[model samples]
Target chain A: MSEVILELDAVVKKFDDNEVLKGISLQLHRHEVVCLIGASGSGKSTLLRCVNLLETIDQGTITLFGQSLNDPRIDPDQVRRHTGMVFQSFNLFPHLSVLENVLVGPVRALKRKRSDVVDEAMHLLERIGLSDRAKEFPERLSGGQQQRVAIARSLAMKPALLLLDEVTSALDPSLVGEVLDLLRDLATSGTTMLIATHEMNFARDVAHQVAYLDGGVLVEQGAPDQLFTNPQHDSTRLFLERVR
Target chain B: MSNITDESVSEERPSFFVPRRKQLLVGRRGIVASTLSVVIFLGGLVAVFYLAPGGAAVRRFYFDRHDMWEAFVGNHNAGLSSVGIGIFTNIWVFLVSEVFILIFGLTIAWTRMSKSPVLLPFRILATIYSDIFRGIPVLLVFFLVGFGLPPLGIAVVSYQSVAVYGCVALTLTYSAYVAEVFRAGIYSVPHGQLLAARSLGLTNATTMRRVILPQAVRTVIPPLLNDFISLQKDTALLSLLGVIEAVNAGTIYQDTKFNSSGLVVASLLFLAMTVPLTRFTDGLIARDRKRRLASS
Candidate 1:
């Protein structure tokens, strides 16, 4: 087996009086793709947020490359530097042009020289097929284009792990295909990713491990063919039935 | 298949074109509306101002052309400076105070918004400061800072010039109001922006300076300008502090020449400064709305 890039051991999270994530455990190896499939409010987004340290977990440890990320001595910002996240809404900095959005992380956060990063940033934009729109603001682009720019912005950081939380959930049906296609290419190129998605077919095609979550509990998880063909849990079968 | 074939045969495509002559009718209606507005509103105002019973006496006292030009050029006989020149003092005070207000306001706002345990004490202090300054009237703050501070024998606070006192007072008061505006702008930014910035490993300070503040400042420009317009007018309050600003200069001329036309000239100068800023702010708001509509 490849080296583990992420390990969640019975991680738990809550909000006020509600338990959003109930002792969920998962793991991803380097160059592996893990797709978390769940209904809305099934704690999929919250689980991804925990891995990124955007939300602190209530219990259990999240280990990243053998480092205990939840340790008090660990700086969340330092941990985040090694991981990149793409939100549901593009959330591109409206004041920045498309090229600047991809450049901001390396130049400002990583302290790379702008001249050194400009070529690589342009290459990333070109890969997304948006080099021509480099000078335009995010709002000027279509929803699919903006989301692709967002993905490119994250990729610019060259993070060890990428967390995508329902990236296509907010996109129009016609636009979802473009973003999913980009993700498919990323998966093929062996970028380690933990994606929370609603698309069953995309999950089956791309994910090395498919985890079905129902109401914050990991109902069943396995290779996509096995999980889809024969879910061990009644809830998992029921979910697949309804979604299909 | 049969229904689709029948529908395709009978379907008529919608026309999006409008005739040029029909479009011209909108321009004609606009012209007529403007003409009616001018005739009713502007003409009515002119008649009321010139045909009133006390019109002659009022004109002689307030709108006398000789007094206006004399006041504008300075009452050389009375050894008073021109109201036009005195306006420069108000402008200087406004410009200096605005710089300080913007810096101090953003600092206080950032301090108040910080969630770090290290900033707790500073946050409390900032909150109290804003609360006290915003709760009291600006005039009272002016009196307190202008009349009350200097007598305490503090070296930095003991400025002799009334204009210096005016600048200090204006900065202290307007900074509080502007701080609230900045805070509102910061909050108006969605939480997702903060998350996105943090996920990129940008430190809080860097995120705020590079990402958050640029967006916040853009969102708050119109309201910030509104505050500045109020601040510019309030510079006239410096006249009460014995600063020889435009209004005070006008008062000196009125005392010497026994006519109020000097005050009219001062009022006109103030309107000239403020109206442009007001219109500019309106244009910004309209453009922002149009941009939002277009994008969404």
Candidate 2:
């Protein structure tokens, strides 16, 4: 039995009058890849933000490793340390070098020794094959290269779970392959991931489980093969048909 | 087929003669007209300087090269030449108050931007300080801090020199203006940058210092330099506090020599300093524009 790393039960979030995520319930287990798929404004990105505590949930609860996140006693920063999120826009610090961006998490947040973190930062950059561009700023990099650095930055924190929100949607179609290949490799290496993405083919190939969301509701969730091909809900079926 | 394609391509070419000739004629006429206007204006001014009935007086008071020299370097009782000491006084007050304004303005800006409930009172105080100081004329602030403080017979302030009083007044007034500049710069940073930093587990203060401020400060440099240029000129206002800076020195020479050449010399000195700084700021703005265009 795999340990549930993250679980949401009836989590609801609203912005002013708009209910972005309504009574959403989902779970992610250790070493598992879960993909959330839906049309624009369907609460896919909002759900990931709520889990990371970027957006506060208006009701229900989020639990990580059996700890309730709704408690005010829990610091959002502390929660974020255990869960890393990569943005759709590849939000690398433009002023900092690639290596410094990676090292900011470990050295500034975690209070690790600079010398120790420098080696780890270089090792992470090496893994992404961006070791040569370590000293270059984000503005100098291509979108694909920058997204890879963003992932390396998150991975440097040694997060227990990673959340990717539309990571490849902003990239050119040609550049998308490199980042998707990187994610495929990360999955094979057993990194736990929760992704909100529009890449149905990528989700079909890489996701252990796929969940369909429609207008702030989770319509259906199951193994990728079952959900993608044999969706039990009409909404999921309509969504799959449209995307295909 | 090749000859037919060539004929079609040649037929599609637009004529370049009529509009090109019109543009050339307009550009040449504009150049000649501006050149003639500049020459006529400059010649008229020179004719007035040399041929008017009061030309001799004008030369003696405002254009006498020797009087200008004497007014700039004429020694006062303090042993240093008037112009020498005047430049020194202006530089000293400008540099000191500049340092204070940078620190005080950025602190006040941060205070106003703070969101914590515990800091609400401080935020209101910062807002009031900026509003009141920026609203009042800087000359009034000089009089108040310079003259008003000493007569109250307060211990440390009462014993301070007139120059120190002027420095304090300028710092207070300009810090208010600069604080608003900094606040605008800080807010100009994209909200997404803050989101990205906070999502990485960095605290609010850490995010501001590391992510936001560096970018904000870069964007504000041109405007900050403009403020400093104004501050450099405002050092003359210190003369009202009996600080004996450039304008005061010029006034002394005008009174003693019964000529305005000293005043003209002082004006020229200020122009000399300000013009280069103005050009430098323009160059910086042009370069920044080019960089933005390239990146976009």
Best by TM-score: 1
What tens-digit string does per-residue lDDT give for candidate 2 at B1-296? 34475554565668756575556446578788778789999999999889999998888878789878887887656332476458778888989999999999999999999988999999999999999999999999999999899889979978899999889988999999899999999999888788778888998888889999988987888789889999988989988888778888888777777777877887888887778888988897787555634432
Docking class for model 2 is medium
lDDT of 1 by residue, A107-161 (tens): 9899999999999999999999999989887888999999999999999999999
Per-residue alpha-carbon lDDT of candidate 1 for residues B132-231, written as tens digits (9 for 90 to 100): 8888887887788788877888787685677888888898889999999999999998888999999999999999998999889878998899899899
Worst 10 contiguous positions by lDDT, candidate 1 chain B:
B1-10
Instruction: Flag regions of model 2 displaced more than 4 Å.
Output: B1-59, B77-81, B275-296
Model 1 TM-score relative to the real fold: 0.92
